[model samples]
Target: MPSEAPVQPPPPIKIGGHCFEWGQRSYVMGIVNATPDSFSGDGVLDPAAAADRAARMVEDGADLIDVGAESTRPDHQPLDAAGEWARLAPVLRALREAVSAPISIDTAKAYVAERAFDAGADALNDVHGLRADPALASLLAARELPAVLMHNQRGRPPVGDVIADVRAGLEESLAIAEAAGVRREMLILDPGFGFGIGPQQSLELVRRLGELRCLGRPLLLGSSRKSAIGWALGREQEPPSTRAAGSAATVALAIAAGADIVRVHDVREMADVALVTDAVLHGRRRGDPA
Candidate 1:
């Protein structure tokens, strides 16, 4: 099928002193996992080390840092609000003072989000898409901060095909956000890759990612170092750190498909990929004296 007709991007969203000019170029969201059991083996346990890592990512061209204390990988350790906050607090406080870029909290618990907001998190990256915690929407509405409400298929029965399921899930999450007075422009949509589907389905989601732009919000693609890439490369037993090449391939394709943000573990390398791909697809040259 032909790619969807291009639509004008919505107005820029300002969060934590960063202006996200959608459609001008793709943004890079560097991930900082504070858990001991991260799937990617890049988790940082010390608060200072995490802050240092975020500073390095920003230096390497990350637009924002996403901090998470819990591991979302398969069979990972389960974390409660108290446990998560324990690991996330010092890290968030350190990041607030360490880097100039905005910070996004990756969690679904309202209690954790509330405390994270107080501790200086600029945005929310709710993987559960408002389905796990009802209070999260109200908090976001009250804070009026930016958020990424992903179409999470985990533990939910599919309504239809991949795109259909993604659309349906996102629409439901949007409805929930709307009811709580969360502004439309403050929310970005993500198709929850590998959250519920297998490798092929995750790849299909990225291949047809352009179709989701009709949802009228910016899209965020986060297939970095995920198992789907390993499966695609026929190296299922390889470490996540070795998936950078596969990850870069998806980032390029997703950028061409109208992805506005790419959440990644390898910030410097993916930033280069985003820069070049953005140049080719959107004429976003690095040294243009615009």
Candidate 2:
């Protein structure tokens, strides 16, 4: 019998003042969509309510909070810069007062990212991988904030092999980031599940996620309540709230495959899921001292 390969631990990544020691523990990023049209259906209309939710997520063990003002679901209408800023400003301000965890702004617009960073967001998660606004790469570089460069092929057909295509695309994005003066330690790569992937491709990505760590950056998986789950469950038309179990499954699998961070909406439940998955993968029993 062949010997099993040794697991490769991800390198530590720092964003703002937080240090994420990947492979030691899985970090959790809670979602806070502040728009009415979020595909996840958890958007809060009130800024105070959003702030409260942020506090609850932190209490529930969220290592970070990702606040988004616009809907990025396929075919969703895009919000203007001013509109996005208006929706995110109050919530960002409120969250600043509520939690100490690093906050990330999910936006493709450079202007929106600038304002959010100015208003206290510690990171930027650009779904477009800085392609939507080339200037965003420069903005992230200038601000010296860590950014997630997700692989998104919005208008293309599924590539013949999902993982290969994702790796190629992310390599290009990394080149762009470097050209913009972003440091290698400041980059996080997301495979962009459901952004352009079909059901099979999404599943394969989760199953083979370890391959992505070869890129040498911390891996962030954001499969929470995504459409890919609905597709896999034969409920593509169902609401996001109904996909918790599937999301949990992905979270566990992602951790097993070497994901450093799991971004989720069901913070409390998924945090528990990450804890158990980490214990199993790393050979630590539950309640063992860290």
Candidate 3:
């Protein structure tokens, strides 16, 4: 008999009226940095400009918009709860009114998440994976919001093989999210690319991303315009703004490796990339044109 097809994970729970059906097609999450010191050089300090960017992302086919006030770049100065809230609140409020797509607050602080939720944000994109603040999980559970738990260990040296290292870290993160009353359906996993880990390790994780499916949750890949991509392209000495094409290449590879959503800075290009990739991987008909 022919081999049985792999069992796909259940559909993702709806967040802010968006149904993320895993394996149907990959989704795009656009990045909207609201800080003055974003590493990607795409920061929009003005609330109005931030809102406009969010709207444009939605128009560019972004399924979700992630707004971050504090930069997650390595060794970056951390923003306090009040400061982060001040930057995120206006953007979240404006995007809530300006765009129909779900708005994710990319913050590790519980206080900021609370305020963002109150300001109409729909999800929490925690880079610390609920480890930064004890109250973060409780808030996410209480609000019953969708979350992206990423594995980040700032300044930690690589311990073993890249995939094995990432897998172990994500397993711990998954346990924390589950223990905090966050349902499996409402949780997504990210294998922290470009965070603490080396640039080569980041590229290795993208190539070996399929292994993460053993956790049985949707996987989100956020390699857009990161320094690692630049390094892979021999542009480590250059700026991040030039990594768009490299980012697209990684996005396509991640999708083929079982990424459910790709968080990106250049939405228009990545959205188109996802469309063609989806058609090739999941939409190709046997008798269709070559």
The TM-score values for the models, in the order shown, are 0.97, 0.94, 0.94
Clashing pairs in 1: none
lDDT digits (tens) for residues 98-151 of candidate 1: 998999999999999999999899999999899999999999999999999998
TM-score of candidate 1 to 2 decimals: 0.97
Model 3 agreement with the true structure over 170-222: per-residue lDDT tens digits: 88877887788988788898999988888888988788888888888889999
Which candidate achieves the best TM-score against the true structure? 1
Model 3 weakest 10-residue run by lDDT: 1-10
Kindly report which residue stretches of model 1 are placed more than 4 angstroms away from their true locations once superposed. Answer: 1-5, 287-290
Residue 108 CA displacement from its true place in model 1, Å: 0.2
Model 2, 161-255: lDDT tens digits are: 89888988899899999999999788899999887777788888888888887788888899999888998899989998999999999999888
When summed lDDT is taken over every stretch of 10 residues in candidate 2, the lowest stretch is 1-10
Residue 269 of model 1 has an lDDT of 99
